[model samples]
Target: METGFPWGSAPSVDLSLWRADAIVLFDWLMSTDLNAVPITHPAQKQALADLLARLEEVGITESTEEEIAAPRKMWQGHGLGGAPIDQSSVTRAQGSMTQDIT
Candidate 1:
């Protein structure tokens, strides 16, 4: 089985995210201490840095705490399907995931 791509090979993929979601993601990534995450290779670190650069290039930068918090609060109880989500449960899950990574 082919386990991975050859060296220097990069496949392109397109990602589409809502602006609010992208803002939240960019904030999280920017605030994260990647050295604490178990990255296996230097390329992974470079890729993350590259992603941050791309986000900034498109004007996503350090937002005020209020700006970062607003989107999370706004979407807390709603899902893409407009179904109600359990805010507390989601919060707990996010907390645990953050703990696991950090």
Candidate 2:
């Protein structure tokens, strides 16, 4: 469906983006932020939820600390609320750039 806000001036949305990624359409979803105005259609809501669940299950966007930290010989003894991430891995993931979606 073509979409625009009531105030006008915003560009129309091409919802073909839903098919862009079998994994996750981070490109069109504002880098996977999903901060847009709600799509009120029930089917749209359900589809979105299903897609999110699939992504989380496969660990693409949702992964345990071990999956992330242990892969690179960066595991240190527990500290700072975590196993003290190595400076190398620390650089890969900054605090402000990460989010806990699960």
Candidate 3:
């Protein structure tokens, strides 16, 4: 649970406790708070690198560096100018969407 400090709280889960082998960890970061934590120190960097390697060894091509760096697809023509979107949504938008009645 010692994630160097100040982190380990966002998304409110202990990143160090859970199995680095779990794909959910990566997905959680990507979908929850992508910028919540920065892996700058050598320890954090190595931990992440190990996770990626483990993911690769288990045949998970989804977390590849190239794929992660590749441009994300957009919700075309949303007037958002090609903003990025989360990779998954297990629930409703949690906000209202009004109809444009003409």
Candidate 4:
């Protein structure tokens, strides 16, 4: 649906979906940080919950503290809340300079 906000303005949305659709949605989400937001659809929330559960099952949810710390330092140094930025907030300004989606 066309977002009614002004041209180039943030979109407002609401939606729902099933498990398979939720998987794809969450996969997109894992690429972002949860703190940032114009707000993802509610389906995105359910999808993320599901994805986290799957990660727990696969053992990827458990990370070595040291391993996690290295990236944390790098992200802070780069001036991101941590690299991946915030999931809900699209770092559009960052993108204008970096040309990287993440």
How close is every model to the real structure, measured as TM-score? Answer: 0.53, 0.28, 0.28, 0.37
Candidate lDDT (C-alpha), each: 0.65, 0.43, 0.39, 0.43
Candidate 4 shows a clash count of 7
lDDT of 1: 0.65
Residue 54 displacement (Å), model 3 = 1.4
Q: After best superposition, candidate 1 residue 100: deviation in angstroms? A: 30
Candidate 1 wrongly placed segments (more than 4 Å): 1-12, 62-66, 75-102
| Pairs of colliding residues, candidate 1 | none
User: Per-residue lDDT tens digits of candidate 1, residues 1-102?
Assistant: 121345755655555554566678789788899787679898898778766766776666755778678778877657888767887866654443220110
Candidates sorted by TM-score, best first:
1, 4, 3, 2
Per residue, candidate 2 scores C-alpha lDDT tens digits across 49-96 of 555654454444544445444433433454558665566655564334
lDDT per residue (tens digit) for residues 8-98 in model 4: 6554344433323233343445666765634559666555555555544444435455544533443463433534555333343223322
- Highest TM-score scorer: 1
Candidate 4 error regions (>4 Å) = 1-40, 79-102
The candidate with the higher TM-score, 1 or 3, is 1
Clashing pairs in 2: none
